[model samples]
Target: MISDDIGKRILCLSFNQTNTCLAVGSTKGFRIIRLEDSKTIIKRDEDSQSNFPGGFSLVIPVFSTPLICLVGSSSNARYPFNTVYFWDDYKTSSEAEIHFRFEVKNALVRRDRIVIILEKITYVYVLNNLQALASIETISNEKGVGAISYDKDIFVLVSLSKEPGHLRMENFYTNEVKSGQVHENPITYVAIDFIGSIGASASAQGTIIRVFDCAKLEVLYELRRGSRPAEISSIAFSPNQNYLVVTSNKSTVHAWKLEKKEKSYTSMISRYLPNYFQYSRSLGKLSLKTEIDLTCPYSNITGPKACFFTENEFFIACLDGNIHKCSIHPVSGEISIAQSLQYFGLSSVSVVERGRTWNNIE
Candidate 1:
C-alpha cells in the first residue's frame, strides 16, 4: 500500500484485467473508477456497516466485474493481514473468505484464478470454489514481486528467490514451468503483457529494463532507462505489446519500443564490441506533470503509476490523486499530455515529517 503516514491515506491501487477500470484503496475504504469517463462506479467507505471498519490495503477487481478481492493493512485494520475477502459489490457483502497462517504480501486475481503471495510461498486457488491448485516455494519476496497475464490463457511470473535475480514462470495452459534469471540484481518489478507472450522485469539497480519472450525464456530487449540507480515503481506493456512504459522514483516515465530480436546493427556491433552495445535506449520520456507527496511512505503512492489506454495513449496516476492523460507521437517519440483530472473525493494531503520508507515495511 502506498500511504501518507501523516494521514494514512491511499493504501493501494490496481487496474482490472481489462484495463477498463481502476480500484483504489485508502484509509477511508476503496473505490472503483471507470477509465473511460473517470467516474466512480462504486465507492465503499469504512464507516459503512456492511464494509469493514478498517480500510483495505489492497483491492484487486476480478476482471472488471463487481467482485473485488480485498486485504487489510496494519493501520486501522479490520480484516486480518492473512485474510482475503471476496466482496460482491452488487450484493454489498462478502461472498467468501480465505485465511492463511502467514500474512499475505500480495494477491493477484484474474479470470478464475487467485494467487496469494506470502513471504516465501505462493498459493494458487480456483476462484470459483477457492480450491487449492498449487503452492510454490520462493525466495525472500518481501516486495511481493509477481505478475499475472490478462489473457484467458494464464501465464504467471514470480521471483524464484532461490537466486538473487532468478524468475520462475508457469504456463497453466501448457503445464510447463520455466525458470531463468531476468536480472543480475534482485528484481524490483515484473509485468506480463495483455496476452502473456511478453514479460518485462527491472532490477533494484533500476537502470535497465529487460523484456522477455516468456515461451522461450529468452531476453528480447535490454532497455536502458537511465544511468543512475532508482527504485522502479511500475512496468506495463501496451495493449498490442509493441511498446512498454516504466515509472520509477526518479519522476520520469520512460517509453521503449520492444522487439523479439536485436536490431541488425546491435547484433553486428555487439560481436565487435562489448555486450552492453546491445542495450536499447528509450524512445521517449515523460516527466510527471503533477507534484508528488515526498513524505508518503509507499513507492506505489509517491511513484507515478501508468497504463496504456491504447498503444499510443496512457494515464499516469500519482499520489496527489491527479490522473494525467497522455499520448506519445509514434514517429517523433514525443510524449504529450492530453488532460489532467483530480479524483474529487480522494484524499490528497501533505505531511510534515517523512515516514519510514515502504521497502522496510513490506
Candidate 2:
C-alpha cells in the first residue's frame, strides 16, 4: 500500500503478503482503518526525537502462525539507529510494543521471516514468537536496499547509491549466491509478479523500467519511458501479472502490458494544466492547443499517487484529497474512470487487503 497526500509532503505506505502487514511509521502516528466496515481500529504515535523525527521508511508484513509487521525508520531520527522493529499486531495494549529490535538499514518481510539490508552489512533475521530465531550475514557492501521480492527459495535485493544500480539474489536458506547484475541508474522500486518468477525495477531517473527473471537474476526486457526526468516514486504489478503501473513526480499514470502479443502500454494524462495560455507558450514552436486538447476533462490536481486493486482496477490519489478509481483493459490498452471518492483528513493514501485488522496502542 502507498499513501500520499495532496501536499506531496508525506507518503505512508505498507506492504503485506499472505497473513502479514508491513506499515510505514508516520510522524503524525499510525492509523489502521478496516476495509470492510471503514472503521478506525488502531492509532499509535510513532516514536520521534528532536534531531531526527521518527517515521517509518517502509513496512513489510510477514506471514507466520502469529502475524508480524516489519518496520524500518528513517536513519536521520534518534528513535533508533538503522533499526528494524518486529511488531505483533495481535497485542492488546496501547503501546503495541516492539517484539525485537535489530540494527539494520532496511528490512523486508518474506513468506517465512524477514530480511534486513544494511549499508555496509547485510543480514537476514528469521523470527519465532517475535524473537530473532536466526541471523545470517551476507558477504557484500550494500549501501541501500530499495525493494525486495522472493520466489521459490530465491530472494532478490535491489541496491542503490551514487554509483550504478545492483541486483543480487541469494539462497541463504540453501546457501547460494547468484551473480550481481549492474545498471547505470539508481533503482527506485522493484516488484515481483504473483508467480514470483518474473519481476521489474524502476529507476531513480524514471526513464527506465527493467524486467528480469527472478530465478536467473537476469534482465529479460527493458522499457524506456523518457518523458519525465524525476525519480519514479512507486511501481506495482497488476494482480494477474499482465500489466505494470508506475507513478512519478510528473503526476501522470502509465500502464504497461506484459504479454508479448499485446506488448504495449498507455499513458493516461488524468490532469490537465490550469493555465492553458501559459502552458501553450512554454511549448516554444509547438502549438499547444492543436497538439493537445487544452479543454479536456482532466484533473486539476497534481502529485498523483496510484496502486492496483486488481490487475484491471487501479486507484489514483490526488493532492486535492480525492481518489479516482479506473478500470484498465489489458488487451485494448484503454482506461476508464469508474469511481471517485473524497476522503477528508487523508494526507496520504495506501490500500491493503480489505479484511486485515489492527489494534490501537492507546
Candidate 3:
C-alpha cells in the first residue's frame, strides 16, 4: 500500500537508489515501502511512528547508498531547523546527524558531497564525516533548488546573481563560478545532467525551459512546456542523458528527446553543436521542439510528481494516492500507460535509477 497517510500527514516520499525500495515519511513517523507485486508494500505497521522535525519534512533518499535523510524544518520543531538527520534504514530514530547554523532551504546529494541550500548561504559537506568543506553567501532566493549531474560528478546550485534576474553557479571543488542573465522572468526550476556539464532552467514565464552548457556559460536549447502558464513540479534527465522528463501543474509529464546527430554527413569538417543549438538540426540541439505527454489518458491533479524508471519506462505519482507506470515505445516515442497502482501517497516520488540492496531489518 502507498501508505504515506499512515501517520498524521504525508511529509516526504522518496525512492532509494535502486528504485526497489521507497521511503515514506509521515507526520507521525516513517517507513520503508518495498515496491513488490506491482504495489507498495510496507514492512511493518510500527514503522509509522516518527519524530521527524515538524514543518516541511523534505526527506530525501541517498543515491547509491542505504540512507534515508531529511533536513529538519519549520521554526518550532523539536529538532533544530538547522539540523540534518539520517534516518538510517527507515527507522523512526535518526542514526547519524549533522547540524548547520542557518536553516536549510534545500539540499542535494551527489557522490561524496552533500550540497545544502540555505536562505543566504550554501554549504558543501563531505558525506562520510559531515565535515564542512565550503560555504558561499548566496544571492539566490530562499527556495533555490540544487541539481546534480548523474554519476554524482558535478553539483550545481542556482543562486541569484548580483545583477538581478541573472543566475550564477559556483563549483564546490574548483571554486569556479559561472554567471549569466539566463532569463528575464524569475527562474522557476533548475536541472543538471549526470556529469554536471549541462544545466536546464525554466523561467517564471513557465512556457519555456532553457538548457545551458555551464562549461561555456551559454544556452544550448529551449523547450516549450505549453503555450499557457504552468507551474513546473520537476525536471529530471534520464541516466543516459537521452531523455529529459518534466512534470508540471497540468498533471502531465513531458519527455523530450535530446538531439545529437549520430550519422554525420562526413566525418571531416563536421560542425560542432553545443547542447542548445538554435542552428542546424545535426547540431547539439533538440531536433524537434515537440514533446509527447507521458501522462496521456490520465486525469489531472494539483501537481503530479514523476521520474524515470528506465530508458523506456517512467512513473508518475498524483495527490490522489495513485502511481501510474508509463512507458515509451522505442524509436517511435509513443507513450502508453502500462500499469497503475492505487495505493500510494500524494507526495513527491523518487525512483532508484540504480540498485544497491541494503536494508535495516530489526
Candidate 4:
C-alpha cells in the first residue's frame, strides 16, 4: 500500500528556458506555475480524453512559450510511453505527438529541433514539421541522462556509456561531434550552460562533478560535491553561466563558483601532485527541512528539483508539495531560505485572487 501511494506522486520537474516558470509532472497531470509569485498560470487536471490520465512523468516547456512536451507514466497511462506529446497550453490540448519503436526515456525541445531519446538511440527532428534529421546511437541510457543548450545555435551532449565515463557532444548546426572521457565511473547526470560555452557532468560515484569547455571538450574544473556518494537529483547552471548549483538525495543543495581559467596553480606541489588534490569545493550549501529521510536507501521520495530563479536566488521544489525560495550571499557563500509555500495540491484560487489583472502575455 505504501509503495502504491508513493508511485502516484510527482515524477519529475523542469524549468523553462527563460526560467520564469516551472513545469511539474505529477501522477495526475502537470502544472505551470509562475516563479515570481508562485501563481498557477496554467493547471490541467487529469482528464479521461485528450490528457495524461495516468500522470506525467516529464514535462518540458519550450522557452517560456505556451508549447510544452510531455511524457506519460503509470500503470494505467492512457498515452503511450513510447510517444512524446506536444501540448499547447494556450489551446489546452495536445497539438501533435511523435512515436518511436522503443520506450522513450527522455525528450527535449528547442526552438528549431526536438529530441526523442530511447534506450540506445536518440532521434532529432525539425520542430515545425517533425522531419527526421538525425539518428545518433548511444550507450545504454536507461535514465535518458542528457542536456541541450537553449540557444539559436545549440550544443547537445549525451552519456556515451554506463561505465568508464565518456560523453559525446554534437552541434546540430555545424554537425561537429566532440567526445571526452569525463570520469572513471558511469556518468549519472549532465548539464550544459546557456550558450553552450561550458558543460558539467556528474558520475555515478557522485563525489565529483567535472566541468568542461564544450568547444574544446577539455576539463576545466573538477568540483567536489562531497567525499561520500549520493544520488544526484539535479544539476543546473545559472543564467549567466558563471555559477552552478547541484542537488542530491542527501537533502542538501550546494552551489559552486565556476572559473573558466585553465590550470594556473603555480605552487611547487602542483607540478608533482596529481590532479585529484586540486578539486574545487562548493561555495555554500543549504539543507532542506523535510520529513522524508533523504539518506535512506529505501526512501520513496522523489527528492527535490532546483533551478536558479535569479543570479543570487533559486527555488527548490519537493515532491512533498512544497516550494522553497532561497538566496545565497555572493561574498560569504551563506545560503538562507527566504520563504516556503505549500503550492502543490493546493487549489489555484487559494494562492492568487482571481480578480487580479494579469497582463496579456504573448
Candidate 5:
C-alpha cells in the first residue's frame, strides 16, 4: 500500500545513467528508493541543519557514483543555497563544495560534469575536480531537475527569448550553442532520449510537443499532449526510444512512437507549403503541428508527474501519497494501473543507478 504522505511536496527528481534507482525530493527531505519495490535505500532528514535548511528543493546524483551528490535549498538556511555541496556521505560534511554568490535553483550531473543552475545564471563544473567550465545566461527556467542526460556531452534547457520560445542546447566539450524555436509559445517541457540523438519540447499552450534531431537541429515530429491550455508536468523517452511518455496537470498521459509513418499526398503537399509546415531556416526541416491519451496509476489532481519505468511502463505520483505503476499496451498505446503503492507526498521521481546509503549527520 502507498503511504498517504511519502513526501508533502516533491520539489524535484533525478535519475542516474541506468535508471535502476530513484532520487526523490520532497517536503520531508530527500530519499533514494529502489524501483523493484518501494524499498528506501537511503534518506536525508530535512529538520537537521546539517542536512538542509528547509527541505531539499532539488537533488541530483552523480552518474553511477554512489558517494557524490548535489543539492539546493534556501539561501538563508544554516546549510545555505549559494553553494553546490559535493557531499561525500552526508550533507553536514562535504569532501568538496562549490560556492556561488548566487543561490542555486537546480542542478544536473553528467559523467564528467555537473551543471549548477542559479535563478539568473548557469554554471558548469567538471565532476572530477569541481572546476568551473562554462556559463550560460539565456536560461529562463529552473534546472533540468527531472531532465534527461546523455552519456556523452550534449544537454538542453529552456532559454530566454524575446521573440519566440527558444531552447539553448550545449555541446559541453565543444562549448557551442545549438538553439531553436520549435514553438511560437513559451516552451514548458523538454526531453531528450537516452542516447542523446533526439530531443522534445512542449509549450504553455500545451497543444503540441515538437520532437527534433539534435545533430541537424531539425524538427522530426510532434506528440500532441492536449488541445486545451494545460501545463505538462513531465515528459520522458524510453531507453529504447520506441515510445515517449508524458504526464500533465490532467489525469492522463500521451505516448507517441518515433517510428516513421506512411506519407500521404497531403503530407507531401504540406512539405512544399512552408506556412503549413513551419520550416526552420537553420536546419531546413518541417515542424509537425499534430496535437493529440491514456490514463495512469493515480487519479488526476492539481498536477501528476511521471517517468518511464521500463521501455513500456510508467509511474505517476500524486500528492495524496500514492505511486501508481501503469503499463502501456504495445498495439493500442493504452495505459492501465498495474498496482498502487502506499507512498505519500512524493513531489518528484527519477530513476537512478548507484548511490550511497549514508547520511549527512555526524
Candidate 6:
C-alpha cells in the first residue's frame, strides 16, 4: 500500500502508535510520510554545516498522537558532541522544527518515555512532561548495549558481555529491578507484541528466536532456523500475537506460531525457506494432505530489512526497495504473496492495523 516514490535509503521506520502517519529515517534526515495522500507532508533536512546534521537512529510516534513524531539521533561521531534531538512537526507542515534537544550517549523511545542508555548509565525520560523518571547503570563487559523493550510499565534491558548477554527487567515508575536472565551469546534484537503479552529476542548468531511471557518472566517458546552463521536482522510479532515474522542475514524469512497450552507457550516453525529458488532437484514425491508455499512474482530478489503481520496479512520491505504484500495464516504458518511494488530506499517498516492503541483498547 506504499504509493510514494521518495526513493532513499531507509535506516529506521515507525508508525505513530495512535494515528495513520508513518515516520521514516534515513542517512539524510527523517521524513513524515502521511498515509492519507501518499505524500511526504513534513520533511526535516539535516544541516550540512551543523555539527550534527540529523543522523537519526530511530523514529517513534507519540503514544496517542499521530501528528507528533519522536526522533532519536546521536551526534556525529567525528564531532565532539554527544546529544539527542527531539523534532516535533505538524502533519500539515512542509517542514519540521526541533522541539527539544538533549545531550545523551544513546536513546530509544517507548510508549510513555524515552530510554537513554549512556556509556555507563541508563535513564528514562517520561514523554508526557519530558522529565527524567528513572535511571540505572548498565553493567556489562561489552562496550555498548544490545537491545531494549518496554512492556506495560516494565522496561527490559539487554546488555552484552564477554561471558554472556544479560536481560534485566525493571519497573519504570518505581525503578525496581526484577530478575535478570542470561543468554549464551550477545543479544542482537528484541520486540514485544502490542499487548505486551508475548515477546521475542534474537542473538548475534541469528539462529534462535526466544519467545517469553512478559508478565510471568518465563520463557514460552523458541524457534531455531538454519545452521550456517547468520545474524537476525529483524523480529516482529503479529498484531494478534499468533505469529512472529523473522528475517535473518541469509535471504530467508521464518514465520513462527505460538501455541499456548496449560501453563506454557510452544513455538512451531511454520515457514522456513527462501521466497525464491531454482528448485533444481526433487528427491521424491510423497502423499500429503496439505501444503503451503510462497513465491514472489519476480525472482532473484533480496530479502527484506523488516517485516510484520497486519490483519492476517504480511508486509515485507525488501532491500531492493520494494514492499511486498502477502496473505498469511498464523495458525497454519502458511504464506502466499498477494502483490508487490517498487519503492526504493526502504530501510525499515512498521504496520498499524485498523484498530489498536498503546492504551490497550481495541
Q: How many clashes in each structure?
A: 0, 12, 14, 0, 23, 2
lDDT of 1 by residue, 39-86 (tens): 889888544444554467778998768899988766545687789999
Candidate with maximal TM-score: 1
lDDT of candidate 4 vs native? Answer: 0.74
lDDT of model 3, residue 121 = 73
**Alpha-carbon lDDT, every model:** 0.76, 0.47, 0.57, 0.74, 0.58, 0.48
Off by over 4 Å in 4: 1-8, 46-51, 155-163, 260-266, 274-276, 292-301, 346-362
Give, for candidate 1, the lowest lDDT window spanning 10 residues. 353-362
Candidate 6 — which pairs collide?
Answer: 8-345, 10-347
Q: Give the per-residue lDDT of model 5 (tens digit) for 1-362.
A: 11222213455555555665567655445677665586666766444534453445556666545654655544225446676667665444568777778767667677776777665566777778878877777545543322435566455433343334776666544455676677887676677776667777777887777887765557887655645677777677777888777666665566676677678877677757755253221111111121111111221123555668688786665444456677777876666778877443222332222231211111
Which ranges of candidate 5 are over 4 A from the true structure? Answer: 1-9, 46-53, 90-92, 142-148, 152-163, 174-176, 269-302, 345-362
In model 4, state the lDDT of residue 128.
Answer: 99
* Deviation from native of the Cα of residue 114 in model 1, angstroms: 0.8
User: Which lDDT tens digits does candidate 6 get at residues 161-231?
Assistant: 23345555554444545444535676656666654556677666766667777555477775666555676
How well is each residue in 18-113 modelled by candidate 4, as lDDT tens digits? 678888765557788888888888777443334555666678889878899987764325776688989988888799999877778888778988
Which of 4 and 6 is ahead in TM-score? 4
**Alpha-carbon deviation at 337 in model 6, angstroms:** 2.8
Please give each candidate's TM-score.
0.89, 0.63, 0.72, 0.86, 0.76, 0.64
Per-residue lDDT for 331 in model 3? 73
Clashes of 3: 14
- Output the number of the lDDT-best candidate: 1
Better of 1 and 3 by lDDT: 1
The whole-model C-alpha lDDT of candidate 6 against the native structure comes to 0.48
Q: Encode model 3's per-residue lDDT on 1-362: one tens digit a residue.
A: 12232223344455554455555544444455544444444322243434442323455677645575665435226666587777665454578787777776666776587777776677778888888987767565555555654355555554556554567777655668888987787775777765777777777666777777866558776766667788776676666767766776666677677775455555233446442332222111111111221111111122566667677677665544456677666676666677777543332332321242111111
Give the residue spans of candidate 3 off by over 4 A: 1-7, 15-22, 34-56, 73-76, 90-92, 150-160, 171-175, 261-302, 343-362
